[model samples]
Target: MSLGKGNFQFFGGSKTLYELKQNMATIGQQLQKTEGELSQKAIDPTASMEDIQAAQKSRDDLKMRFDLIKEQHDQMEAEQKAKFAAKDNIQNIADPNEQVMKAKAELIKATIRQQPIPADVKQILGDRNNTGGEKLLPTTMSDQLLMEPLVKNPLRDISTFTNLMNLEVPKIAFQLDDDDFIADTETAKEMEVTGDVVKFGRNKFKVFAPVSETVLRGTNVNLVQSVERALESGLAAKEKKVAFTKSPKSDEEHMSFYQTGSTAIKVVEGANIYEAIVNALADLHEDYRENARIVMNYADYTKVVSFLNNGNSTYFAAPPETVWGKTVKFIDAATDPIVGDFSYSHFNYDLDVLFERDKNVRTGIEDFVLTAYVDHQIKLKSAFRIAKVIDTP
Candidate 1:
């Protein structure tokens, strides 16, 4: 009738061990009582051989029963060894009390191992790639604790994200004071609103494996210099494993990795400004070769012509015959296009500067963003499709 763990012989034999010990104590007490009763009796001169035989037989039976119990306990231990091993291999089942204590120790170790993530709380796995279209997965205890460091603190835990496009507005609206007030005049103020939606980071994008470092300092190394040499020679094992956001419920999931290597600036080349900007961006690219843009801003090329041809431009020469020279011209009162590039600066990130200095012109793009930076004195400002992408074999 026994089923599951209750039928185990070890637990059943444990009870037998207790009962046997109790029985042994009872036997000792009975022996003492019998000895007292025997001491009070007088010795019989003619003792029968049959009584002695009966006493000897009773002693042999008791010895045999005690031996049987000992054998049963020993066999109990042997029979359960295989079962315990099977449970350990198949499932991680072990002593429940010890397992719980070990789990607690693991929790403590995990907590201790995650103290190095204070600096990264501002950034989560999905910030780089905006994909809030994934399903949420259940996380283990370790996964949860590890996630705390991986997720940022500023925005609390986000479950779903939706990205909305920024809305553009047409023409500016202003308020003006009128001296004449009609008897029943109506004043109207129109509100022009541009849309910028706030989307969830986690819900929007899937995070890949996070960046981590694995140390391999062998105990055999005694000297720091030896370890240094090992590190330099690439003798020790090393790797950069990338991490990303969780996947969403639906298809067409976008996964992005958290990277901080370098940043890039956007270049908007117009008809007149195309050739000059191509050369400018080319120089930046020739210096850098490869880089990623955080964001790109595209302005109107017609604006460049407006700034140069408009009456505000200061002039050193006339409309059509100026060669490639650094001179000034005045048309309209608006500032020269050169000022716009300097002010807006197409490349404007400190991180771009840090990783892209000297050999790479990583930043300073924002200064070039607005066409006002160009003095507009150059003869030709831009050309269309002048900067073509040539494929090389």
Candidate 2:
């Protein structure tokens, strides 16, 4: 018997391709064995009639099984071709409106190819023209196909600067201590004892995605994709901006490394940036100085490019990849030429990202709501290790 209603609709029928292939393989092996035996009997000059007859009978039985299996396999393939042809025919409609209707129906039926549009959403589809349903359908072809792809966040992979740790609870606890291990001397008193220098604290932050029912159900696929894009982009840009431009206003967040007084490398008026960057490397410790990278906004990066173009060619060899033997990252939040080992920074979160769907929670919302959120914070291990070359304003 077949499985569920439309489990194998895409495969043409409910019969699994695995089972069909296995059956064919078993039949093929039996046929090969029988053929091998028949060949052996014919090659032997002293073979008796009984042996030859038995070999012939085995070959006949195997041939029947092989033929039956081959026929079934061919039939399944034909059915698949027919099913696909029918699907294509449905898609090949001449009229644009008819094509859209067919596509919507296929989208509704083909759950694997489509994100789940809940029952509440389906109900709203008919009533999309009602009040508060202005953006009822997706505007683009590609957006109608699937969910939006995630925005790429380069900081997520950094090991030194950002710790991308998963948290099960609301806060991440850690111990801060400036005390170092003492070298005991025979003449030293009490092994250089000191007071308790350890401090305990937790990092906490709340990220919220307040999605409306109109966005979830009333709008089309393109709007849904846009909403997803906005959520991810906003999270990435805001967190990085807060880390690089704004200091932590409360205990719930970590302080920005840019705010560290000792981390700044002031540039003289009309001073060459290339020389300024070289000097800024000294601000970071020698251990991390080798891995130091330059961060600037696209505008600043372009200005540097123009400066290099007007000067010596070998001075700024690569255009976008490297500048003065160091890798350059163009971040929107970066206002100055910041040099640091960003890998030392950390971003903590829950494996279950803050985004979730809630149908009954929203009293005013009439449709299903999908809220994408993030619970995360950026931590600076050693603020002094990051140096920013600021222009005199």
Candidate 3:
């Protein structure tokens, strides 16, 4: 099957896409070995027709299996394409309000599936039709807003190091040093006892959204969408800020991997993109090279893709999911490619979310105010293995 940047395929669901490629390589090698054995049989003067036929059959069987694997890979690619097209259709809808509402509904569905729905929320949503008259106490027509499940957030789903924590206390302490290690033997040397202790305190992030009273009580599904948009905007910005913010000079905020002097950094020279990527990988410490990842913006990644598509290089094979045999992630914030041991970096959360709503006696505006609060911390365990390439002409 023809493979390109857009139509890349992978199989073996639980295994990473790269691992499946390794399987294909193994199959190809076995086919080659079997074919070689058959060639030797053909050259033997005492070889019988039965021996040659059996060897040929074995090689043919391996080829068939390889073909089947390729077919499965192609099928997966087609399915992925269809999914992307469908998602695009939803996103490009003509009506802006309808588009946002649909997206918000999806998010609501996802959240409801995972957590218990509050009685008040259920009452507000279930009473959409307003079946009861003014005399009916609980079945008032004023609460007609419909609700949907939550949409799944891709960042939270795909993040390797992000985690959730449930803590009654606001702060957690981490020991930077282990319980002391073994030293020189024989003539006892003085034991080294000095180390640093860092405290990870919860930082609160708050955001507010104001909605008119008419929109809040309206039966229109768009109302939920408006609220969702405001909340999502805040949350998305917070996530990006936490992940990509440059490390600070002091302990004012959490240090990110991109900050200068925060970790190992390298400068890339020359015009060849492929070689520059290899050099970035090389800059990683030998200990973390095996697990290192290359992160770059979509534009830079597209450049690499263009190079591979040309098929001019003889140095190494380029696979769809990897470069230099390591996983590659396309991130918009990654202006320059970063080669890092991601396992050493982690995201910690003290609370998932704290949402509050106020209706009466608020600001002068005739709108309800909704506020959301989140607490989290980011910690980089080690910086020795991480490095970013500073591209220069």
lDDT of 2 at 114: 30
Return whichever of 1 and 2 wins on lDDT.
2
* 61-138 per-residue lDDT for model 3 (tens digits): 778767766666567667778888777554556686565444434334323233433334334333332433211211
The Cα error of candidate 3 at residue 42, in Å, is: 99
Lowest lDDT block of 10, candidate 2: 182-191
Give a tens-digit lDDT track for model 2, residues 1-393: 233336434333445656777777876888898899889999999999899998898788667655755666788888889988866664455776555544443333322223553433334233232453232332222222112326645555442221223433211133236333222221122223321121223343333334454544443454345454654565566457556665545552443545534333233222655555666666555545677677667776666677877865653456665665777776777655666566545444322222223333556432222222233332223322333344567
Best by TM-score: 3
List ranges where model 2 is wrong by over 4 Å: 1-149, 157-227, 260-270, 311-317, 351-393
The TM-score that candidate 2 achieves is 0.42
Better of 1 and 3 by lDDT: 3
Top of the candidates by lDDT: 3
* RMSD to native, candidate 1: 22.6
Report every candidate's CA lDDT. Answer: 0.26, 0.48, 0.49
Per the 3 Å backbone cut-off, how many clashing residue pairs does candidate 3 have?
10
